[model samples]
Structures are given as C-alpha cells and as structure tokens.
Target: MTRSTDSWIQQLSTLMGDFYQLLAKMQYLDLDQGTIDYPPYIDPEKSVDTILATQLGINPEAIQLLQRLPYVAAPARWNHGAGDEEFVLYGCFADFRKDGELEESRDPLYASIDPKDESVGWEDEDGQYMRPWYVPLSRLGNHGVVLILNMKNRHLWVIDQEGGCSDPGLSDVDWNEDLVNKNSLDRYPSRPATEVLRDLMQKFISLEWIPGGIHHGYQHHHYKRLYLAHGWPDNFDSPAFNATRQVWEDEERAQYSAERPFQDVDRLELWTQLPTISSQLARCEAENASPAWHAQFQGGSGRIPYESRKAELLARLPGEQQRRQELLRELEQARRDVVGVSGEVRRRREERLRLDGR
Candidate 1:
C-alpha cells in the first residue's frame, strides 16, 4: 500500500504545527530560538485553533495554517509604523451578516431558492464565485500583505494595502518588487498555501537570522546561533533568500537614513551658551554658599580650613571670568571670520557673473 500525496502533506503540516508549538514555548521562556514567537498575551489553556475560531470565526483550514505559523507580537507597529499591531497568520471570510444580524436575503442562491422555482437563478454576491478568505501572514509596522483565498479556486492570491490583487503566478515577484517601487501595495496570485508558507518562512529566516539592518531586533544574532546549533534547513541557502535579504537591507538603510538628523543645531546652541558659565557659577555660589560647600570642596570635614577653601573658590572666580572674556573674544572673532568668508564668496560669485556676462 502506498501513501497519497495529500497524506504526506497532512503529516508535514502536523510536523509544522509541532515546530511552531515549540517555538511558542521558547518565546514564553523569553528565549530566542526562532524567527518568530507566540504572543505573550495568548492564554496557554486556549489552543491557537480555539482562539482563531472564536476571534476570526474562520474555517478549519485557516485555523490549521495559523497553528502551523503562529501569531507574534511585532516589535514595531505593522504597515506605516503608526500603531501597535500583531503579525499573525489567520484568514477572514465575508460574513452574510449585517449589523450583527445574518441577512437572509444575502444567503447563497442555492440556499435561498426553492427546489421547484425555475425563475430563480444562481447569483454570486461575494465575488470570486465563492466566499473570500483573507489570510494575513506578515506585516511591517502598520502595513500588511494578505493572502486571499476563495472556495471556487485553488490558486492563492496576494492582496496588498491598496486592495490590489496580484496577477496569477507572480505573487512572490510582485511582493519583492513592491518593496522598492513607489506603488508598494500592488499584489498578485502565487502558489498554493503550503508553498506560499514555505517561501515566506524562507524569507523570514533570511531577514530574522541573517545579520542585516532590517532584522527584527538585537536578539537575532542569538537566534542565528541557536539555529546553527539546531541545524538549519537544506533549502536555507538559496539565491532567492539572498536576494530578499539584500532588498530588506537596502530598505532598512533607506528608512534609517530618512529618519536620521542631517544637521544637529543643539551643538551650536551649547557653544553659544559657553560664555555664560562663569556667571552661572557665581550665581550658584551666591545662592548656595555655606560651610557645607566648603566641607564638600575640602573632601569632607577638616581636610582644609573654611577660610582656605573660600579663598580657593574666590581665586578660581577671576580665572573663570578671564576664561569667559577670552571665549567671548573668540566668539566675536569667529563671527567676523564668517562675515569675511561670506563676503569673499559673494565677491567670487559676482566676479563669475561679470565674466559670464562677457
């Protein structure tokens, strides 16, 4: 007797679920063992299946996929980085409910029509000729990319932030391409759910295990060591993985540069305040001067006489004032130097204009 392909697929899916469960346990222990971890807020007694069924009201297949992949509390908000959001593998289906009530008029034509009514025809209201299922696998900040499935079709579809579905067989390519393109929300159809999960896992490993700017957090290095100790999968070293890593690295660099301050004005302001230090010190002494201050300067009591410490502080005040005057002179000179340089630049520009006029 031979096992069918579906049987093998089912076995692999079960193994995947076990793997995710281990990953989730590791997360609870605050160990960096894998690319993703289960959300800490999830109740241990409630199975992932139960949570999905209760929260999303999705089908068994969707629950199975979520169990295999698991949801993670993302370090940053999803898409656009605007709000706190979780990255989870789950699907949503269109409900025939309106305002908390199921609308009988919107039921499937087969369910609504009478067996003998010839006038009633099959009407597809949900589109795709079947009920649509939206499965969001990953999100960057507040932005999301969801896998759209339908009962009528075996092909998987990718829907982006803009609500555009990718062309058939081009989901992976379009997803990668959109990372660099201005229209980042364009989507396409891809392989089956299993293959899509495999590909996404590969990409996640590369981004989360490999050293790069876009890696999730500082703990990635630790997870990389753990993966190595546990042994990485044979398919981990693919060209596609490397290409995706490069794309994430480039995007991370761009985001970092865009957020960085190019010119910091605070340093200039500090320099401008430097000359006032002597006056501030004098004011502090006048307001808080006491035998305690003398003792503090003398390194606790009796190290030096109070009169001697007072003389020392007084002696330092003149030097501080002198230094302040010198700094003010230097600042004035710097201003004059800047004016001279600006005049020279203007003169050179005028000379160039005169030459150009000739």
Candidate 2:
C-alpha cells in the first residue's frame, strides 16, 4: 500500500486474471449502495460502448476489434472525463494480446523494425514499434478527457476539455476507500481508471515489448502523461489517423493556448459530421488487411500473427460497394454534362444560320 510507483506496480504484477477482473469493474458501478454513473462527454448521456454501437453505427465486431491492440487500424471509443484535466481514450488492457498470446512471453526475433519496413503505421505520429493505441486510464462516468498511448516511447498524451497544466495520474489510489466524483482531479476513481494505463505501461516495460524488445533499444524509458495541446509527436506505428497537425499548429493552437487552453468541440457540430468521421474511421480499419500489415504484426512484430483476415475483409465489402457507387454517380454526371453541352452548341449554330438567311 506504499505510495511510490514501484510499490503498486509490484502488486499488480501479472497481466492475466486479476487485470481483466479489475479492469472490468472500472467501466461501471462499483457497488449496489452507490448510484450508477455514466460518461458525459459522449452524447447528452450514453456509455462509450453504447454511443459507438448505436450512434456511430459500429457493430459489436468493431467493438471487439477496438479491444485488440496493434488493431487492424487505430481504435477509438467515447467516454466522459474528470473535466478538470481528465479524459479517457476508451480502450482496455485486453489490448496487450496483439492477435493472441499473453503471459509475459513471446520474445520477438527482431526489435526496432524500421518505420519504413512496415506498410501500416500511424503515419508520422509515432516512434519505432510504438503502436498508436487510442486508449488509456482516464476516469469513466465523468466529464471528459482522452489519453492516447504511444507505448513505443512509454508516453501518454491527454486531451481534456480545457487543461494544459501539470498532468495528474490515478496511481496510489485506494479504490475501495476513494469516492470518484466527476469533473475534478482531486476526486479519484473508486475504480482503477488510471491504474489500467500505468499497469499496461509496466507490462510493456517488463516484457520488453517496447521498441527495444529486450535489446539495447528504447526500453529503459518509462511513461509520462502530457497535454495533447498541439498534435501528435514525431512518429507513430500503424497506418492510423495522424490528423494533420499543421492546420492547428499555428493560428488554432495559439488561439487555444492564449484564449481557451483546452481542446474544445461542439457536440452538435460533431454529430452533424458523423458521416464524414465514420467514413474516415472505417477506411482506416479497411486498409489494415494488407499482407504486409499482417506480416508486420504476426510474422515479426512479436505477437501472434493476424488470424481473422477473411472476416475483416468481408466487413469491408460494404465500403467497397459504396466507393463503386460513388464512382458511378460521378461518371453519370459527366455524361449528362457532355450531352447538355453538345445540344447547346447545335442550337447556337442553327440560330446563326437562320440569322444569315443562307
């Protein structure tokens, strides 16, 4: 029960049974005596899972995909934040199993695969071997904050409604005794919201699943939480959504820093744009079935090789049909425009000949 980092980490040593059990309780009610809580950041009111499945049109399979790490694409979910510098990236510890196989084993033959060697990556927003997992140990059933994991470097980035000061963590909290209140940093979770993240980082470090992978690489470093005020850092692994930071780097960033100092979003506006957002997210998932993607994840990346290729590809057929339909529409419009132009030209010629009295 010591408050030091090393102490609690030693207690949560194993990544199996207890990890899942403890992690499961963090998502919902702690006991019957207390009230059931829900995250406020998503809709007027809805759990992260419900919002994803209902509003976003994400199926159950997609939710399961989100739970898996080195996911076909970068995964994401909705949840409330503690408001005062707190957010949840909304994934689970289950991500530790990259396809399958958990238990502090799987010594990858190679470490530090070149960023270029892998076909799919989070583009320029991650370091080597650092899978860009959109998850974390942020408070659930609260206000809102998002913690993005770059385990490749043992670092975390927090995106809150309006916070850019010293980051806070959930380590050393006595979940049994603590009373978690929404929208406050001092209020700790009765659940292990923060612990999930810290423990995962510990496992990553202990198993040497980082960039080094038991080699003399980037394994010595630990994790740190930072305010995602600007955009992603230098590089990230996985062909994920590395949204262009350049657009926000200048005017928008300065505006937030000087004026608001938080990543703000209008929920109504976002809802209106769901079609565009959903399409983009689907595309990210759809692109991950490439042979190179599987090879990188299964063949050498140290985890079990991807086994559900056909299922994933089948899921993408709808997107393929949608794309084909869009192309046909464009082709039809082009033909109509050509016919209209030809008719206009003929009419103009006839009018000139009549005027000339030929």
Candidate 3:
C-alpha cells in the first residue's frame, strides 16, 4: 500500500464514511445498533461481508464489491481570479464485475435485434457481441468543488477539498513528463470506454436518470422513504389527478384487464357512456370460445344466460330494422321527386318549341 497515491487512498477510506452519511440521508434510512457497529463504508477489523449483510439487508456473501479509483481534486489556480481557471480534479471510480464481464452477465445480448437485416445467412450482430453495461456512479470536480453521485439511488456527495490561496504546491505548476507516466489518470466505466469518459465529464454539470430542461414528469421510486420525502420535483408541474385519470382511461380501453387495478376508486373515473350494446354483441360473437371474455362482459348488471343476452340483442335489432325501412322509404321518395322534375322540364321545352313554331 506504499503507492504514490497512498495518502489519497487513505483519504478515500476516510471519505467513504462521509459518502455513506450522504446516502443514508438521501434514502432517509437509519442504521441499527448492529449496523452502527459494523458499517460498509469503513474497513473494519472483521469481514466487510458480515457488516453489509447486517446493514444493507442483503446477503453480503452473494454480493460482489469492487473498489473504484478514488475521486480527487487539486487546489484552484488563481492568477487574480478571472472568469476562467484550470482546476485539477481527481477521485473518481467505477463499480464493475470482478471478472471484467458484462454488468448483466446473465444476458450478454441485452438489446433487441435489428429487423432491417435481410441477408439470407446473416446473423443478428448488433447485440450479438455486446456486453451489458449498467448503473453508473460518478464523482466530479467543477472549478474547486467536488461533486460525487450514486446515480441509481440519486445520492449526492460533496466535499470542499480545495487548498486555500496561500497553498502554492496545490496550485498550477509545470508538469514533469516523468511524473505524468507515474500517475496516469484512472479509467471510468462505459459501454464503450469513450462514453464512460463523456459521462465522467458531464457528471460535474448534471445528474443522470433525472429529467432535464424546464419541464419534468413522473419518476418511479421503489424506496418508500425517498419517494415520500422528495414527493416529486417541483419542476414536475403536471397535476396528479389528470395524470391518474389518463392512466385509468388507458386501463379501461386496454385489450386485457389490468393486472393491478388502481385501488383509488375516487381517482379512477370511467367515461359517462358505457360500452356500446353493439360493441358488446360484437365482442360476444368474436369471443364465444373464451370463458374469460364471457365472464367479463356478462358479469355485474348484465348477468344473464347466453340465450337471454342473445334475446336482448335481438330485441334491439328490430328498432334498427325499422329505422332502415324508414331510410329506404325516404330514398324512394327522393328518386320520384327527381323524375317529376325531369317531366316538368320536358313539358317546358315542348311549350318553347310550339311558341317558336319549330
């Protein structure tokens, strides 16, 4: 552990405690006495696995943990503090598989195949050679302030590590070519390594998985504490009632019944007009073999025998039949009117011929 970055590494060990505090606060979680005794952030004399099991509520034996390069930040260089300044930043690491395999090793080819490929012997090569990449966490330094985040959980870690203006060693200086190779920049994780570098750059300016720009929408959170506490970002101005209404309507008109029905009856209002009687008849005819379809349509107020349902549909058919007859009568009258008008025009033409003596 006598590496050039040993002190920085030790600083990381210390920093993990602070990072853990931030995560705990973000989740609104509390540590039990056992967890307090053995936390995951710091290296205890005992196995870290035992501690993770006690604290995180997961089987630590099953979980694989990897140490990422610690994020570091250099002091700000101030030549009298103008708008622009070069700040040296450090202390960023990524979590990945211990074996250098895909994040989702169970499914190496995660993305769907492209349908455009039409070669007779061609194989799906898009996700064929791809590896699964997931759940990136990043640490960043802007100017002199360091911002670190666990993207999946939306945890933010901040530390002001910048040395004061009096510290010259921490500020900008001539770099030795020898030292550059000795302590190279650590690599970040990406689907392709380039994307990882890009993400690392953007992490300082933005947080991932969060909606950007002026408008924001719903984001589902599984952790109850985080969901209930944060309540949705203020930028998400969409009314909850309206959003819920649309969801309900979508469920109602959906081809299949919703697996999980909305329990809030007051919120889920259906349209004033019920399913049309004709539509019901059509559905009945199409789904005659399906008992489930029969149960759905024939349930509740319309509970009756199949014969009775048929009779009810047949009972309404006569009214439609009567309307059809009325329409046919009107069509006949219109044709007669046209013939009478033609006869009158013929009579007028004959009168004109007689008057002209032709």
Candidate 4:
C-alpha cells in the first residue's frame, strides 16, 4: 500500500468489505443452490457449530445454506487418498466461505492436511461426508487468505497464502498501519478481526488443537456446484446494484474505485424434487451393483431389503461387514434428507415443470 495523496483507495476497500459483512449479517445474501434438473442437491441438513461460525466470521445461516449446495463434482480431484479417491457416488463440500474474512483482516492463514478432530480423519477409501471443503492455498496472492472449516466434523484448517510459514515477509503483516513497508522497523504485529476469530475457535474440534501434531497439504469432501435437471430458481437472479454510484463518496473516490463483486445468494436450494431425484439415481446404481458389489456391477438384483442383502455382498473379508454398515448409514442419511420437503414446495415444483416442460 503506497501513499496516494488522496485517501479514497483505503476507504473504497473498507466499503467493499463492509458491504459483504452487512449482507451476511442481514441474512439477505442467498446461499441456496437450486434443484430438480440433472444431478441434484439436497438442502443442508445439519447445523454449523455456533462457536465455529463465530470464529470463521461466516454467518451461521450462510453455512447452513452452503451445506445444501454440495459441489456437483464427479470424480472430484482429490489428493491424499489411495484407490477409492476417484469418487462418483458422493459429492464433496467443494469450497469454503472465508475469502471475505481474509481481505478485511490480514490473518496469517495456514493450509494443512491435518485436523484436530480424530473423526475428521479420512482414508483413501472414505466417502464424501467424512471430508471437509477446501479452496486452493495458492489463492493467497500477496494478501489473499482462505479459512477452511469442516462443519460436519468440527475440524478447522487455516491456509496461509505465503506458504513460507516461517519466513514471512513484512508485506504479509498487519501492524496497525495502512501501509506495511518491507524495510522499516516501526511496529509490532497488530491484531485484526480475523486473528481474533482464529484463536477463539480451536478447542471445539474432535481433539484439542495442537499445531505440532497436524500435517500439511489439503483434503476435501468437495462437492462441485450441481445444476438441477429441473432448472434455476425464479428468484435466483438478483438485480445488480450500481456499486460504483453507491460507494463513491466523491470525485476523488470515483477515480480510485472499482466494483467489488459480491457473491450472489442463489447458491443454495433444497427443494424436495432434486434430492429425491438424486437419491433415486444413486439407488438405481446401488441396485445395479448389489449383485456385483464385489466385481463392480456384473449383474443386478435391483435393490433388496437391508437384512436380506448383507448376505449377498461380494468379498466377505475383514472389513466387509463394516463397509456395508457405512454404506447403509449413508443411504439412510440420504433417505432422511428426502422425507419432509413441504407440499407447497412440491406443488410449486410441479407447476413450474408443467409450465416449462422441464
């Protein structure tokens, strides 16, 4: 940050950060992803931990909505796992919502393959829900930072863009001044809102937070943005604002200002039809695979009852029974997701499809 005789640059940046924080606090930012078309998504079923929410500076409401919008990723690029890493059955938590946190306050973020929660650990053969969401650590350009949270497992990861955790530059430090100079000896590191948020959030994970025990690198339960076979929601399109007009305080401000595009809220949608369709599709594969789970779909038994089916699974080895149990639990979770979508939402969906032939 160099001295511009005019102070508009600093002010404009503050205004951009404030606007996002405001929308989230107001709960007007729509985080819902849509449903009904092709590959479907379910609304978020679980709540993000309150303590975790406060620390990430993400609105808890936003997270609940985000969970509904799993990445529609098929065979998502995953590192750290072995054979079962190529996944199609489960969509992961494709991304986290902390970009705003970093810009507003320069927190020293770090990336890690390690997490404090023991349950948060994943094997190469593990399925989707067991993983957390991640954004690339390289996103931290000069000052770009991202915070990764595994709400399902209550595990947290901090990604420091610098990558040089030990040899950080003065450019990366926030020392209570607008411009942090590289060749000066003036101030100590100052605490920003993000730093405060980071410290208060460590203890709630599955294990106590200990920096020494964790590993480096990233992991995922990544889900890509899935489009519904049905189509986009009617209100998904929010009217664009005249950001330039709104934020420019004066001519000097106008010269230095550029729009800070905020994330639109239409990202979350949990309408009943989509998840039902998703379950049906997955169930179709499960049924087709039942006769051939061992050999990866040789024949088909067409989905059988739980008690009667266990005897039929191929390869009865040391972990066969446990694997079957996890699969059942995952299936049951999907079923619970579809159980109570409202009649009105269903009626509206029916009306829309009938009208549009979607």
User: Residue by residue across 1-358, what tens digits does model 2's lDDT show?
Assistant: 1245333233323332233323223222123323222212234222234333323333333333233322111112211222211112221222222222111111111123342445534332322322222223222223234343322222444434343211245344333324232222222232242454555444433432221111122112211111122211233311232132223234334443432211122232333355455656656655655656766656666364344654565576677657656655555555444444444444544443464443
| Tens-place lDDT digits, model 1, residues 58-130 | 5445444444443332232112222333222221211211212112112222223332333543342212211
Best by lDDT: 1
- lDDT tens per residue, model 3, 135-228: 2232222323233322222232222234212112223433333322211111111123223233433432233221111012222111221223
- Whole-model Cα lDDT of every candidate shown, in order: 0.40, 0.32, 0.31, 0.29
Q: Which ten-residue region of model 3 has the weakest summed lDDT?
A: 181-190
| Residue 291 in model 2: lDDT | 55
Candidate 2 TM-score to native: 0.19
Error of 3 at 143 (Å): 34
- RMSD values, in order shown: 21.7, 24.8, 25.5, 23.1
Candidate 4, residues 97-126: lDDT per residue as tens digits? 333422222122322322333553233222
* Runs in model 4 lying further than 4 Å from the true structure: 1-21, 24-66, 69-143, 150-153, 163-247, 253-358
* TM-score of every model versus the real structure: 0.33, 0.19, 0.24, 0.19
Model 2 bad stretches (over 4 Å): 1-143, 169-358
Query: In model 1, where do residues sit more than 4 Å from their true spots?
Result: 1-45, 48-141, 149-155, 163-187, 206-358
